[model samples]
Target: MIRTATPDDVPLIHAMVRDLAEYEKALDEARATEEQLREALFGERPAAFGHIAQDDDSGEVVGFALWFLNFSTWRGVHGIYLEDLYVRPEARGGGHGKALLRELARICVERGYERLEWSVLDWNEPSINFYKSLGALPQDEWTVYRLTDGALAGLGAAVE
Candidate 1:
């Protein structure tokens, strides 16, 4: 079963995030703290939302999807931007991942959102295959760019 995450789920979600980063071979970059997640997910005027997937028989949380709303000027509608989706290794192939995504899709349909989107690492063929199986297409023509750390600070300074 999938449900909205509550304050109690914050620690579990943060641990899963670290596990996911370790799996992706980027453990060093997984720097978010539980406090940050709590503030972002459950604070007043929350900036993001999360959904938890639990094991049917054992009632243990097996996966989670963290997402936020994004507006599309062309569609004049809000869409979901999935920041991260992670299922425990022991829980993979048990439909947990699909269930998490299905919940997100349901939310999109209910809200008249134009799209549900997330990025997968290019080298992660298993995830790519799974997404393709779900009818998700690759936006191969576009390149994603980011400005962070010193660059972001420098840019902010210039704007002052």
Candidate 2:
């Protein structure tokens, strides 16, 4: 079963995020604190949303999908930008990951959103195959760039 996350799921969500980072070989970069996740997911004005997938027999939370809304000016509609999607190693192969993605797709269709999109690491062949099985095609023509930390601060200080 998949359902919306609550305040109580914050700790589990944090742990899962760390587990995902470790799997991605970037544990050191997973610096988000539980408080930060709490504020982001359950704050008075939430910036993101999360969904939990539970084991049918044991009713234990096994996976999650954390996402936020982004605007596409060309489409003029808000689309979900999935930040992370994970299922415990032992819990994988159970269709939980696909179910979580299906829930997001359902939300987009219901809201009249033009697209459902997320990024997968190129080296993760398993994930790439899974996404492809779902009919998710890669936007190979575009490159993603970001400014962070010192660069971001320096730009903010620059005079227009």
Error of 2 at 112 (Å): 1.0
Per-residue alpha-carbon lDDT of model 2 for 34-114, expressed as tens digits?
999999999999999999999999999999999999999999999999999999988999999999999999999999887
The candidate that wins on lDDT is 1
Q: What global local distance difference test value does model 2 have?
A: 0.95
TM-score of 1: 0.97
Model 2 CA deviation exceeding 4 Å by range: none
TM-score of each: 0.97, 0.97
Q: Taking the tens digit of each residue's C-alpha lDDT, what string does model 1 give over 127-153?
A: 999999999999999888999889998
lDDT for model 1, please. 0.96
Model 1 spans with C-alpha error above 4 angstroms: none
Let me know the TM-score candidate 2 reaches against the reference structure: 0.97
> How badly does each model clash, as a count of residue pairs?
0, 0
